[model samples]
Target: MIATPVSSPAYLEYGLDTLFGRITKRAECRIGLEQVENDAFCFAIRVPSPLSDDLEQAKTLVLRVEGRRLQGTVRHSERLEDDSLRLEVEPD
Candidate 1:
């Protein structure tokens, strides 16, 4: 079966790496949800350069979907041709 994107708005909360340390930050973005197996899901988001840079250094993240917060690790990320970033997250 094909999975569809969630209709509700999604927000990404992650730590931004800085010279001193990491700072918490959040961004509103759209995400696509796919079920890899029973009770397992994958989240995908596309973000701009600035946010992408932060995500590259992020080890874990919090995703708010429909008011429910899910914590996950940054499983994979890639830079698109337009300089935006695409990320895939697997929730613990």
Candidate 2:
């Protein structure tokens, strides 16, 4: 999948793997592609923490952008002031 910058709200599906071995649900989140690279991109999404536990680094994760299928590992995750989660994805 091509990594391109999107100005408007780009819809992406985040499939995060849980540590508790619960069912992985496709949680829809609005994200902005901060920077796009050859095979990776930086994004910030205000995802609710309750949706999933802290995504482990290098953990396999699923991303769907405009129906464009892409897989990546969790490079980083930060908790926002609003108790939301922010993620940096490393696409594979």
Candidate 3:
């Protein structure tokens, strides 16, 4: 598959099941280009610091962009000097 950069606004959502129903944390983010190397693929996105802890803990999240939903796992994350969190995701 050819990976392309997503220019639309993306949202990340992770949910938890509770007695009250499934509560979800959602944050707006920017979806980077999907990269492929040596037959392996990787995806990435950037979210604000406010959601960093949640995303890191959740590990897996649904990325919604341009009407498409991609389920991915966080492979790695790093905090930028500007405080945004850059996450490396492997789409499943």
Candidate 4:
């Protein structure tokens, strides 16, 4: 789906910590126009960091917007919560 900005420059980006001790910087990962129903949205973010041979494995992370923030997990590897629909993505 990969939602994109329409009227303005508003979108969501996710940063991941990879298994190579490298931090994945923030980048726009819009699921699609149809996916974003309101100011609030939930998306499955994959933290590339692993439990083995990786930096910290990125067990817990944060999701922030305009000041409001929430905590996310990589316990099962990038599984988005049920509050919002999951966006279709290419196979990793």
Tens-place lDDT digits, model 2, residues 45-83:
335544444342325556655655556656777777866
Give candidate 4 regions above 4 Å deviation. 1-19, 31-60, 77-92
7-57: candidate 4 lDDT, tens digit per residue: 222233333565686364333322223232332443333322121232134
Give the CA lDDT, 0 to 100, for residue 11 in model 2: 40
Backbone clash tally (model 4): 7
Least accurate 10 contiguous residues by lDDT in model 2:
1-10
User: In candidate 1, what are the lDDT values of residues 1-88, reduced to their tens digit?
Assistant: 2444544467888866678886887778665445544444776555655444466667678877765677777777778896767667
Model 2 misplaced regions, further than 4 Å = 1-25, 29-33, 36-44, 48-50, 54-58
- True-structure RMSD for candidate 1: 4.1
Look at candidate 4 and give me any clashing residue pairs. 1-31, 2-30, 2-31, 2-32, 3-30, 3-31, 3-32
lDDT (Cα) of model 1: 0.65
- Candidates' RMSD to native: 4.1, 5.2, 4.2, 11.0
Instruction: Give the top-scoring candidate (TM-score).
Output: 3
